[model samples]
Target: MLFASDLDQTLIYSHRSLTPSSKADPILPVERLDNRDVSFMTQNALKLLQELSGQILFVPVTTRTILQYSRVNLQGYGICPRYAVTSNGGTVIQEGCEDKAWKEQVLAGNVNCADVRDLLSKFREISHPSWVLKESDKLADDLFYYCIVDREKMPYSELDDFALWAGKLRWTLSIQGRKLYLIPYHVSKKSAILYLQEKEGLSTLAAAGDSLLDLELLQQADAAFAPSHGELFLQYQMGVFTAKRINNQGIQFTRTSGIGAAEEILRHVLKMLD
Candidate 1:
């Protein structure tokens, strides 16, 4: 069996996502950058994760580049996953080394999409300094790019039109929090998980995530979960999003939100395994 999970906002959370009710829970920092904690998990969640990792092939899948993913130190908390999917599945790592074959495959899959340079140029043309933060534009390992924007000032109509334009070019536009991402159609967590499943000869798969990017991953899993927070949950709650079912079961959601949601997700996964 294999369990693939998205890191940010699904398993680990930033300080801002923690609710007032969860502030009192014992939490441990899982990600640190420049002497500051960037992400964390509750103590109980950590324990459940440690137990889960021991019983299955746990894979941490994320849109983060390899360097950014390194900031998360699961080994320090007694949970070390042998395989990880990074760069939104554009890169896969095995035992701390990049799988060159997988990298080449992802690159080959993206050959038909618009070049990263072209996408960057187009973004610069359409974006304004007032909404897009200065010096916040970033290219992720040459596979995709994003910008931090002032959400309140964001022009929804322009964004919607841009999304349609990008979609025509085989690129996807996703907005999560203050970050807006433009990624290729081929680079996805679902594809990478499938690759891992075949390589490891895993029979059963379970997944958890909380964004539009994770839609395919969750849809493909035998059993899947999403926290009752983040993009997907909010859209579902507002009836704007409908999740596709797998074997007649749609993605399950945790009852709680914030840090408490992390514990709930882990417990559910553990129960499914049991």
Candidate 2:
């Protein structure tokens, strides 16, 4: 079985403290979003994640640059995922290590690297806001990409407009929680997971997430879920895909969300195999 989830608000909270600072309080994972205090995950969600590790392969997909991703401390989830997709599909990291083969494949798929770089640079020059603090390349172990701007000063509306315009260029524009990332449109979380499946056969699959970057991954799963806060929930309301909410209560509810409404999704997969 294969289980995949986005990391930021999906797995570990943003602030991500290892243990509670004060015992009397709820063990919420702290979220450092928009430079404000926000809770990332509930205590119950953490426990359910721990138990699910045994039933399926756990994969984390996130847009976080490899350096920014390393700062996170994931301790109590009980099990470590074997495959992690990072940079929105630019890289696929092996559990407890890094993998270079995926990036090579992605890069090879696109032949016009120089043209892509030139177009991206021009986009930054014309559309970027004046408050741009810094624009820099995010160098992975094997992949190279750039982030648009720092959220501390840029407004969401401006970013949205930039994204809308950027899309016409045939480049992928993604706003993941905070950072605005532009990547090749062909890159996607689902393709990365497929790469994993090709290498190691998948018996079952489940996925959870809260954003557009997750759209492709959700499509790849037998069962899929999103928190009430996820924008994808709105998309689901428009009759897009199959997903249900698990409460903020933590494990018991998450398991119910996964195995209950999503159980039939699993059964569907079993039937397909049979």
Candidate 3:
């Protein structure tokens, strides 16, 4: 069996999303940058993850660029996954090395989509300095671009219109927390997970994620999960997102949020395996 999971806000969380509670378990830093802790997981969740990795093909899937993903040290926690999907599946890694074939395949698949440069230009044309952080606008590995914006000040109508326009050009726009992403339709976690499934001859698949970007993966998986604190969960609660089949049978949601959700997800997956 192969288990694919999103990294940020799914498995590991930043300090802001740790969501401390009186009854919460002790936490451990899973990612550090520049001598500071950047991401963490509950001590119980860390143990669950370590145990899960030992039992199945655990793949860390994320939209983070290769450099950004490198900042996470799962190995230091004794949970080294052999495969990782990064850049929203624009790049795949195996045994700590980029899978050149997969990278070429992703680029080939993106040939007919709108160019990244064009998308970037469109974003700048629609975005405002007051809400969009200038320094945080970045092109991720030439596959896609994103900007950190003040969500409270975001122009929702403008973003909705942009999403429709981007959709016509085979692109997708997703907002996760402060970051807004413009990605090609071809660059998806589902596609990469499928590729790994076929290459590794893994028959059964399970997935977990907390963003719109993960919708496809969750839909395609035999079993899936999303945390209560994620974007998808919030959307569901707002009646903006729905997947009747998956929601009723294939996908499960944790009762808890933050690091506790991570533990719940891992434990559920392990139970399914058993």
Best by lDDT: 1
Candidate 1 segments exceeding 4 Å error: none
Per-candidate local distance difference test: 0.89, 0.58, 0.88
lDDT of 2 by residue, 1-274 (tens): 7767777545554433223442233455433445565444445555556556656676778776666665444444465677778777777888756677887788786673434656556656644555443544453333435554655666667567666765666566655444555676657788888788777797556666767778777766666655444445556567665543232121111322221222322333333334
lDDT of 2: 0.58
| Ordering by lDDT | 1, 3, 2
* Candidate 2 regions with alpha-carbon error over 4 angstroms: 15-25, 28-40, 75-77, 112-114, 131-169, 176-178, 234-274
Question: Candidate 3, residues 33-117: lDDT per residue as tens digits?
Answer: 9899999888888889899999899999999999999999989989989999999999999998999999889878777788877
- What would you estimate as the lDDT of candidate 3? 0.88
When summed lDDT is taken over every stretch of 10 residues in candidate 2, the lowest stretch is: 250-259
> Could you tell me how far off, in angstroms, the CA of residue 161 lies in candidate 1 after the best superposition?
2.3
Report the lDDT of model 1 for residue 171: 95
Candidate 1 vs candidate 3: which has greater TM-score?
1
> Model 3 clash pairs?
none
